[model samples]
Target: MFARVVVTNMGNEMFNDGLFYTEQAELHKDQQFNKWRYCRSAIICFCVAAEAELAKLIAHSLRKQPHLSPEYTEILLFLTDPNSDKPIPKKLKNIRKKYNLLRRLNGLRPQKPDQRYMELTELRNKIIHYTFSSHEDVYAGTILDSTKIARDAVRDFIADLYSIVRETPPEWVNNNSSIDIQ
Candidate 1:
C-alpha cells in the first residue's frame, strides 16, 4: 500500500469561474441593469482562486522539505495527506499567514505581500463586506479597474508560486489571457 496525496482543484475552478464572470460582464455591457454585478463576482472569484492556489503551492513546498519538524510535517500532511486527521491551525486559515508560512517553508525571508496582492485583498474585502457609505463613491471605471487588478494579481501570484517552487506551471496556470472588458 502507498500513501495517496490529495490536492483540491478548487483553485482552477475558481479561476475559471472568475473568467466566466468577466466574459459575462463584457457580454452584458449593453444592458442597463446589473452592469457591476459580474465584475464584483469576478473579483471575489479571483481572490478566492489566488488563496486556494497559494495554499496548494505551500503544501507542495512543505512536502518537498527534506527535514522538517513534526509540527510542519503535520501541517503538510493536513494539506496533502488523504488520510490526515490533524486539526489545521486557526492562523493557517488566514491568507497572510499562509503566504508567510509558504515563504518560511521554502527557506525564504518572510515579508509583506506586494502592493498588487494587497490591492486585490482590499478590493475583495470591500466587496465581500459591502457597506455603502455616502462619502465613498463607486464609479464604473474604478470597478472595471479593480476587476482587472484582481485578475492580474492572481495571475501574478500563480506565476510567482511556480517560481518559488522551481516548478513549471501548468497550461491553465500560465494562461494569463486578458479579458476584453470595456
Candidate 2:
C-alpha cells in the first residue's frame, strides 16, 4: 500500500496511469507487484533524463552555427534548445521522421537518432517494458548488450557534439572532446 501511494503520485506526475500497473504473475510471496517497480524507474529515469539533457545541450550548441557533418548534424536535430522546450533548429527536424520511418537506423536518423541513438532506444525500451526482472526472461540476449549500447550511445553523442564544437571552434567556446575511448 505504501508503494501503491507512491506509484499513484508518480502516475499523476507523468500523466500516464498505466505506468503503475504490475501484473499478478509478478507478485511474490510477500511483495505486491506494482504496474511499475519504483527502484527500476528511479534508477533508469536518471539515465533517460541525462540523455535527454545532453541531447538538448548538444542541439543548442550546434544550432548557433550551421553546416556540420551530415551525421553530427543529424543528432543536433533531436537536441533541445537552451531557451525553451523548443526543438533543435528547424533545419535539423528531419531526423525524427527519418528514424521513425526507417526499418534499421544504424548510420543516421531523419529527426530521431542514429545507430547510437537507436541502440539507446532499444535499451530504454527494454527497461521501460519490464524485461529486466530476471535471468530467465525472454530478452536473454545479454544484459551487457543493453548496458554497452546505452553507454556507447552517450559516448558517441558526446564525441560528435564535442567535435562540432571543436572542429568548427564555435566563437567563445574552448574545449576538446573529453571521451578517451573510441
Candidate 3:
C-alpha cells in the first residue's frame, strides 16, 4: 500500500458569482451560474471537509491496506492565489507541479488519468516552471466535471489493483474498512 497526503489550495480569483470566496452562504447561493472558489477545503461545523473529498480517500486507503506498512497523513490547505509563492514553504518543494497551476486556474486536468497525481508535482524545478493564470475559466462547462470523471477512473483503477490483494486468501484475517462505496 502506498499512502500519500495531498493539500488543495483555493486561489482568490473573483468569479461572476461573487468574490473568490465569501462564507458558506455564497456556496449554497441559488443562481443560474452559481460560483464559489472551487478549491479543496470546505470549512463547516466544528469539523471540516475537503472541498474535493480527495483527503477522505487517502485515509480510507490507509485503513484498508495495513499490510503494506502504511502510515500516511495529509493536509488540504487553501490558497488565496495560484501564484502566491509566499505561503509555500522551502521544505515543501514537491508542491510545485505543471498540472497543478492549470488545475488552479481552469479545471483542466492532466492529459491522462494515470499522470494526474504527479502532473502538478514537478513545477518546482528552478530551471523549468509551470504556468499560472488569472483569467476566466478556460476549461469550464460540463467538463469542469472532470473531477467526477476522474473519480470513476480511480474506482476502476483501484478495483483492478486490489483484486489480487482480496484474492490473496479469504482466511488471512480480512479487513474491509479500508474501502468505501466509490
Candidate 4:
C-alpha cells in the first residue's frame, strides 16, 4: 500500500505570493530602480510558483502508483534538499521528464511550456545574475509585459494540471486532494 501524502495549500500560497509581488511592483512604478527591481522580482516569483505547481502535480501522479513510491520519495528529497548543488534548470528538466513520462503512461498528450514562459525564465536568470544594464534602462512597460507573461504562464499551467487531475479516479488521488510539494 502507498502512504497517503497530504497535499497542502501550497498552490494558494504561490498564487498569493505572485499577487503580492505584482502589487509591490505596481506600487513602485514611479521609481525606475524600485519599479524594475520589484517587477523583475514579481515575474521570478510567479515562475517559481508555476514550477512548484508542476512539481506538485508530478508528485501527486507518482504517489498514485505504489510501485513508484521509492522514486517519488527520491524526487521529493532531491527537490527539498537545499544543500544540493544541482542547478535549478537541471532540476526542473528532471521534473519535467518525469511529468512527461507520467502523462504518457496515462495517455495524455505532452504539453510544452509556451515561448513566453521560456522568455520569462531567461529574463529571471538574467536579472538574478545581474546580466542586465542599469536600472534606468529597464522600461516600465517591459516590466509590466514580463509580469503579465509570468502570470499567464502560471494560470495556463495550473489549468492544465487541474484537467489532468480531474481525469484521474478519485481513489487514485490521495485524500482526493491536490499535492502541495512545497
- Candidate closest to the true structure, highest lDDT: 1
Per-residue alpha-carbon lDDT of model 2 for 61-144, expressed as tens digits? 555545667755655544432344544544444334422322122223334455665555554555666544632332333433
> Best to worst by TM-score, what's the order?
1, 4, 2, 3
List the candidate 2 regions with Cα displacement exceeding 4 Å. Answer: 1-50, 62-113, 129-141, 167-182
- Please give the RMSD of candidate 4 to the true structure: 8.0
Residue 80, model 4: Cα distance from true site in angstroms: 7.3
Q: lDDT of candidate 1 vs native?
A: 0.73
Per-residue lDDT tens digits for candidate 1, residues 83-180, read: 97777765486777888888887778877776797777877787777777511424355676677667778888777766767777656654455333
lDDT of 3: 0.26
lDDT of 4 by residue, 11-36 (tens): 55655566666777777777767877
Model 4, residue 31: C-alpha shift (Å) = 1.0
Better of 2 and 4 by lDDT: 4
How many backbone clashes does every candidate have?
Answer: 0, 12, 8, 0
Worst ten in a row by lDDT for model 2 = 15-24
lDDT of 3 by residue, 107-138 (tens): 23434323432221121121123234412222
User: Which pairs clash (backbone N, Cα, C closer than 3 Å) in model 1?
Assistant: none
Please state the error at residue 3 of candidate 3 in Å.
Answer: 29
lDDT against the true structure, per candidate, is: 0.73, 0.37, 0.26, 0.60
What is the overall TM-score of model 3 with all chains considered together?
Answer: 0.25
